[model samples]
Structures are given as C-alpha cells and as structure tokens.
Target: MSQPPLLLTVGEIARRLDTKVHRIEYVIRSRRIEATGWAGHARVFSEANFDHIASELIRMDADRHPSTRSNG
Candidate 1:
C-alpha cells in the first residue's frame, strides 16, 4: 500500500522558506492559496502550494520594486 503524501503546516513552510508565518498567511489570504488540509485551526499545505507561495512572494517583491520588473 502506498503511504499518504507529507503535508506542511504554515509555520513549517515559513521556516523552510526563511520567512515569517504571518507572511505565509498573508499570501494565502491575498492570493487565495488553498490549504491541502488542516491541523485543528492551523492550515497545512502541500509542496505544490509551497511553490505557489514562493511565486507569490516573488511577485509581491516585484510589485514593491517596479524598477526591477522585467520590461519584456
């Protein structure tokens, strides 16, 4: 039998990404990034969600520095 895939909690994801848990929560709220599951009140996410969160952070950074955005 195959085992279930591992899921990461908001805090774990934040630690791995070198960011604050609140930032991840903000991205989830702003970008509507859904959680894969839940641990009581805490939100849990899949690796795929991690990728999306990272992308959103990069976008947010670009938004804060328009000059760094690609012209093409």
Candidate 2:
C-alpha cells in the first residue's frame, strides 16, 4: 500500500524556511500563495504549496528591495 503524502502547517513551513509565520500569513492574505487544504481552522500545505510559497516569498522580498535584485 502507498503511504499518504506529508502535509505541513504554517509554523512548520516557517521553521523549515527560516521565516516568520506572519510573513507566510501575509502572502496568503495577499493571495500570492494558497493552502492545499484545511485542518480545522488551520491551513495545511503540500510539498508543491511549500515550493510555491517559498518562491513567492523570494519574489516579495525582491519587490520590496529592488536594490537587492540583480540587473543581470
């Protein structure tokens, strides 16, 4: 039998990504990223969602700090 895929909560993703939960929440609130599903009132994310959130965070950072972005 196949095992179920792992799901991560906001806190888990923030810990793994070395960021704050509020930052993740901001992205979600802005609709840049989305949760895979909900576990009660908490949002649950799949690996794909994690990757999307990570990339969106990076993009957000770059947008906020244009000088940090490479011209190349």
Q: RMSD of each candidate?
A: 2.0, 1.8
Candidates in order, TM-scores: namely 0.80, 0.81
Off by over 4 Å in 1: 1-3, 69-72
Q: Pick the candidate with the highest lDDT.
A: 1
Clashes of 1: 0
Q: Tell me the RMSD of model 2 versus the true structure.
A: 1.8
For model 1, residues 6-69, the per-residue Cα lDDT tens digits are 7899889899889998998999998898889888898789989999998998889898999997
Give the runs in model 2 whose Cα sits over 4 Å from its true position: none
lDDT of 2 by residue, 1-72 (tens): 998988899999999999999998887778657678899988899999888889989999999999998889
